[model samples]
Target: AQSVTQPDIHITVSEGASLELRCNYSYGATPYLFWYVQSPGQGLQLLLKYFSGDTLVQGIKGFEAEFKRSQSSFNLRKPSVHWSDAAEYFCAVGHGSGNTGKLIFGQGTTLQVKP
Candidate 1:
């Protein structure tokens, strides 16, 4: 059972609000957790990744995530949600694309922001 699941299909929040996107993975060995954001007509950008070391990992664009082995979850959270944060977020796992990075996208979560 190797796959990635994002519980939230979509999320809406007012500007300057807190945000959290749930992600759970099923994999053996050390899982490589990753969070990415995509804008209109743009490619996916790496928000952050959890390979080894610290359980709590920090990412770019003022984002952070914690890897909980007990819960088998890696949830992304932001202290404040900005208008620009409104985009599609996806949780993926792996290191390569061919079959290694062979990520299993969780449908996808759309984040809407209100001014």
Candidate 2:
């Protein structure tokens, strides 16, 4: 079955530290990959997405991800994490053809920022 997996269920990082969240997808073809962040009470926000073209895609909030077709992975990265970055991060893959806007999301990774 095709699904998304976030190896780490939770992660703790100090403020100003670099962060990297791993995301792997199992699929027949290269599907649309996305990274979303959900704050305490805020809705899910799109951090970045990769469809085609450049492998390294830049996103909002100083976030970026690289699409590795060979490994079927789209890892999210940040140079420095702020306290406000504490929240839940999800990795999702969009359906192909018939299902246009539908997305299959991973369990999610909880981020705990340490001051």
Candidate 3:
């Protein structure tokens, strides 16, 4: 069985402050990982993914994450926050055997931006 979780359902921060989004997962085997961001009523844009090797991964929009096998976590972080960064973030795991894409997503984390 495989499952993904975002520990924080919501996060709020003032502009220019740093940001962090926590994500945890449980998988019977090594899982395919992914992070995606979604703006209001829009499709998800892939931020980054970790399949194997290089525990630390860099992403677009000045974001990065570290994959901890032992901890079963992939946490996203940004040195500074912006009002435009305010949106929903999702963490996912894919164990697709034959299907094209089968991603189990976290409920979602909403970000509140204070200008």
Query: Of the candidates numbered 2 and 3, which has the greater TM-score value?
Result: 2
Q: Rank candidates, TM-score, best first.
A: 2, 3, 1
Whole-model lDDT per candidate: 0.89, 0.94, 0.90
- Please provide TM-scores, in order, for all candidate models, with all chains considered together: 0.91, 0.95, 0.93
Tens digit per residue, CA lDDT, model 1, 1-115:
7888898898999999999999998877667888999998899999998888999999999999999999989999999999999999999887443464576677679999999
lDDT of 2 by residue, 28-69 (tens): 766999999999889999999888899999999999999999
Best by lDDT: 2
How big is the RMSD of model 3? Answer: 1.4
List where candidate 3 sits over 4 angstroms from the true fold: 96-100
Model 2, C-alpha of 52: deviation from truth (Å):
0.1
For 1-115, candidate 3 gives per-residue lDDT tens digits of 6778898898999999999899999988778889999999999999999888999899999999899989999999999998999999999998757546788999889998899
lDDT of 1 at 59: 96
Provide C-alpha RMSD values for all models, in order. Answer: 2.0, 1.0, 1.4
Clashing pairs in 3: none
